[model samples]
Target: MKNIKFLIAGILFGIILSKTQVVSWYRIYEMFKFQSFHMYGVIGSAVLIGIVIIQLFKKGIIKDYLGNQINVKDKKKGFIRTLVGGSIFGLGWALSGACPGPMYVLIGQGALSVIIVLFGAMIGAFIYGVLSKKLPN
Candidate 1:
């Protein structure tokens, strides 16, 4: 029953993402190039809402997300790791013209070419998983 509910929710979410025109490569490209603010506008609004919700929950006005208290904790990492990881992620986003979240949407919309991007992303994740322990703090 839980899996069924999750599957239905996922399907609905994918449909909405597609209907919003967020799954298109052209739209993603425009966002990365700053030629369009459509996607960013949505992202900005979501961030604002998230901040408000988090603040309210922190104040004990609202219990949410399974009643677990939320706290902001910065990851400890060296400057080099941060810089290198960010650069790589940015390069991939620029080259693919799609951020990670939208990549799944693109795939759902029949963009088989995204498989290559997915492969690269998986490899990058694997590398990070392997090297995270050895990376300087």
Candidate 2:
């Protein structure tokens, strides 16, 4: 029964994404093409929410859903690695017309064609997991 809540939440989230048109491929294309601000506005709002949540975690004012204290840790900084990763991620997003989050939502919204994107993402993740130890930290 505990997992039912998560299932409901996911359904609600998928509905919100559909109603907001965030799952639209054209919206993503417009964002990549710099032809519209709609997608940017949506992304900026999410960033703001994430910032607020991180700040709460940093201040010890928020806990996980399981009631454990949130711990924010500083990780090693690698500017070149970050730039490379961001470039690759952006390229993939532009090519696929869907980022990681919206990929499943697209499938849920009857975009069966995006199955290829999802499959590619899974394979990429598997490759990353296999290669992560050999890559820089």
Steric clashes per prediction: 0, 0
Instruction: Give lDDT tens digits, candidate 1, residues 38-79.
Output: 989877987999899877876877774468666655457578
* Winning model by lDDT: 2
Off by over 4 Å in 1: 60-83
Locate the minimum summed-lDDT window of 10 residues in model 2: 67-76
lDDT value for model 2: 0.89
TM of each candidate vs. truth:
0.77, 0.93
Q: How far is candidate 1 from the true structure (C-alpha RMSD, Å)?
A: 2.7
Give the Å shift of residue 98 in candidate 2.
0.7
